[model samples]
Target: MILLQVQNVERLFGSDVLFERVNLDVQENSRIALVGRNGVGKSTLIKMIVGLQSPDNGQITKNKNMTIGYLAQDNGLNSSNSIYAEMLTVFNDLKKMEIKMHELENEIATFDHLTQSQTKYDTLLSSYDQLTHNFKEANGYGYESEIRAVLHGFRFYEEDFSTIIGTLSGGQKTRLALAKLLLEKNDLLILDEPTNHLDIETLSWLEGYLQSYSGALLIISHDRYFLDKISKEVYELTSSGTDHYQGNYSFYIQEKAKRFQQKMKQYEKQQEEIEKLEDFVARNIVRASTTKRAQSRRKQLEKINRLERPTDGQQEPHFQFTAERQSGNIVLSVANAFIGHDDKPISGPINIDLRKHQMMAIVGSNGIGKSTLLKSILNKIPLISGEYSFGTNVDTGYYDQELKNLHANKTVLNELWDDHPTTPEKDIRSILGSFLFSGDDVKKVVHNLSGGEKARLLLTKLAFNHDNFLIFDEPTNHLDIDSKEVLEEALLNYNGTVLFISHDRYFINKVATSVLEISKNGSQLYLGDYDYYVDKKEEQLLLAQEENKQTGEIVSKQPEKNSYQLTKEQQRQERKLRREVEDIENQLEQLNAKEEEIQNQMTLPEVYSNLQKSTELQESLKKTQDKISDLEDSWEEKSMELEKFD
Candidate 1:
């Protein structure tokens, strides 16, 4: 079942073609990623598929029964309802069924007392039973649980559920909108930049949730790690046309390289043959004996389908970081620092010993002061407590996530040239060109540049600084995937140390030699990349759980008890807990099986038509479900206790 098909799609702006000959098919349960450089019209293509816009040259086909959920980059929930109420709107149909079932139950009860009309009584009972069955089949009984689970995944808590939609921030509203869309469970989910406001923890949760999703997903995101996890195939839109890759983002990279090499080889071979034929024709056309043969060869040349020269897709910015001088072994040191603003500490008592050539990534949940800590070190904000220092002769360059250092009124050329007054205008233009600003682009004011352009301009300044140490806050924020790769490569090759804060797990994994996990209380250092930090964090959590378990055991025991007796008692307790866990698990499984069997039996024609038999089965299913619920509770308690011993 193809949920959506885009055939020979083309979009044009005036006389200029944006893209042409685009074709893609989204089958049932497809996981796809749409990737391209900035300004490549990926969002425009999504609009065409969702019927928000029409293609200029071709058609988009969708199944008549198919429903689409589209979340644009800037869209948010618009409602006067509370947060939880807004989410509940997605289940209005189920709610209506529930209300009708209640009404039916009351009416059936009233009719049960009237023995004067037996046929009407039987009819009421049958309708009530049918409605009950439909309610259960529609998951009317458990829709609230589903809502709660999704709300929690999006970082919305029970206490915040009652907050009015109008009171929420724009980002929070956007997140809620996404939560509502996920609850809708449409046939196809088309998301443009779904990873926009998510931190790494939430991103991980979203990845896990989408992995088991039952419908098709079409995502446009610059988060490469996310694309690798959520996408099964990739469609890369380019100015010339669209290219399809049959794998995840990682595979797409490798496969794209292989294809590019093959194309280049074919093009080179064809060019060599063309050159030889043209030379032969030019030399022999004037000679009478070979003129006929030359004419025949010329016709053959005209028939040839000339291959276009292979290119590296769109022109991406080139980045290179070269240090003018090397600093001492110790590049930066922070001692027991408290970082925040307005004489208050939001996070810290932080410590860092950044050494030369070590790219350390600072990571934490959003709003944990990761960026503030960097600002504190850079003297942009006052440190509430403690101190930091740079090593001997170490110069630092900073890349602010907000681009606060850029002057709004300055032209792109002046922004760089002002910093290097001695540099010639031509030389400054050359540097700006490498960063993808050329001619009229150089004259654009800093205030008018897009986020990507501003980011590129900032990088241009940083690259020119030639400092021994660099500190960045969310350097990958506005960069496309291609530009991020370029920045990563530049940093990896630079002979300097870096300490940066990033929510991009992929960027951190690529560039960081160490990871600093920060919290409101303090910070801890892991001597490896992002992946290593996660593994070590998990290990630490397990150790803490085990230690807490041991402490509980010690506190429960009497001091007078002998060691051997305590050990024997502990072992016996563990065995008893394990047995209880296993027993509860088995009982729950049996009860679930019985409940399913009853539901299945009720669906049969012979049983549903017979009121008494259907009623009996429903009663049995209710009992089985109640028993399953109790056993599930017991299973969870016993399992937790058993885990403590392990």
Candidate 2:
């Protein structure tokens, strides 16, 4: 069944047309991810869908009895209420029903004899029982427990629940709002960057919860991994309008490229035909022998509709960062480093070496001293007892999240002008335009700019500067998916030594050649990328589990054959085959796991009997079968390679 339909929707902000002739149909239990650059009207479209804002033209229709829960970018939660009290608001109607049921039960129990009053009491009792049944069916009995579990998953402790929301930090409040949205049972859930304030654990928990949730979900997020894990369809909001692709983010990218290539080919073919027709008409129109034929061709040409070629000018930007000079092997070093503020020790006795052409990520929770460590490295803060050194010829560029260096009183154009006094005005304007500060927007005061705009400006400066070594703190904080992609591509292509702090897993995975994790215990180094870290962490967890099972001795798994130890040609072939097999196996495991989970859920009498939930699960089961078929074909090829090796 169609959950919601948006038909020919046109939205206008003042005289500017945000979107026009937009049509979309959201199906029940569909998982759609909205992606675009900032200020592309993604939020406005969502607002229109939820009836919070009206479109200038067109209509939005929803199925009767459908419910929606929207979590906005700016969490609109009152600061005076406690977290627990705020979440409890979702159950207000159910609580009222429960109270009425209890009152009726008490009255029914007070009747002594089988009189007319007792019959009326019995009738009341029956009505109360039905209401109570619905309350329980809605999971009202464990509602508070569910809320607590969600809160805990989002990094809220029992002790933090009673604290006034006004006292909590901005990130903490956003998390609280996310917790409320997740706990509320609704037919459709719209979440915008819900993972922005979430940690690794909380993100994992949310992934699991959403995988199991029965509602339709529309999420807008820059976290590629999150979108890959949850989204089945990708809705790309572009300058023209929204384009729909029937797959996750990765699949969408591949399919979109293929489509663009096909469109280009067709456009070229059509242009060639049109050119041939026009040349024939021009050369032969006045000839006595060919006048009739030329007139016929002219008529056909008049009726022909030209095809418009696909364009991605807004999506594509050429990003190149020039380096001033090469850095020494030892880019930066810290020995016995002890740093803190107010005499409190954040981290100390730290030893690390950052080398040339190396990219490192410093990862930890909020307020855990990741930023503090960066400041100490830059000598912005005093190191109590440590010897730090930078290798010769290292020109450092620092990108702080606070944007403290930006002049608030200056306009965007003036800000760039002040920094690059020698740069031509037109060149400065072009640079600003690349960062999406175009037209009259360049005249906006720096202080009035949004967080995303400020971040873009800072990054633009960092890119334009000639620095061999870069240090960034929370660089991906307010960037949209497109801007994040641009930054990721630029960094991946950069030759400079880079060390940055980021909470974005996708960015870290793409750029970090090494990872430095800081914990309460101490800091540890990982020699590879984010995926390698995850694999090592999983191995450690399994090892710990085995150790717990056996009292004293460690039970370690035996190592598999090392393909690297083989001959050069054999090793290359082995690596290729292994990667292919791993990809297939991963797909197979995901599909099998989803099938089993769905089957188990459907086996429950209540779930199987529900019209909406049952149908949605059944459709998902069919999609799983299709996925398995594709995986089987890939696995067969890998199996053939294994046979040849044997």
At residue 269, what lDDT does model 2 achieve?
A: 93
**lDDT for each residue of candidate 1 in 312-332, tens digit (9 for 90 to 100):** 557888979988999999988
The estimated TM-scores of all candidates read 0.84, 0.81
> lDDT for every model?
0.86, 0.80
Error of 1 at 239 (Å): 2.7
lDDT of 1 at 285: 95
Query: What would the per-residue lDDT of candidate 2 be over residues 1-646, giving only the tens digit for each residue?
Result: 9999988888887988877877777899988999877777888999999999998899999999999999988584666888888888888988898888888878777766655576776688789879988989988788877877787777776777788888887788888877787778689999987887777656866875786578999998888888877787888876567788777777778778978999999999989988999999999999999999999999988998988976864644446566878878889998877767976777766667999999999876666678888888888887767779999899999999888868889998888888889999999889888887789989999999998889887777877787999999888887777778888888888889899998788888989999988764457789888768766766665557666678876443322222112333443455356546755765675578679988999999999989899999999999998889888987997888766654
Cα displacement (Å) at residue 461, model 2: 2.3
Range of the 10 consecutive residues with the lowest summed lDDT in candidate 2: 557-566
| TM-score of decoy 1 | 0.84
Q: Model 1 clash pairs?
A: none
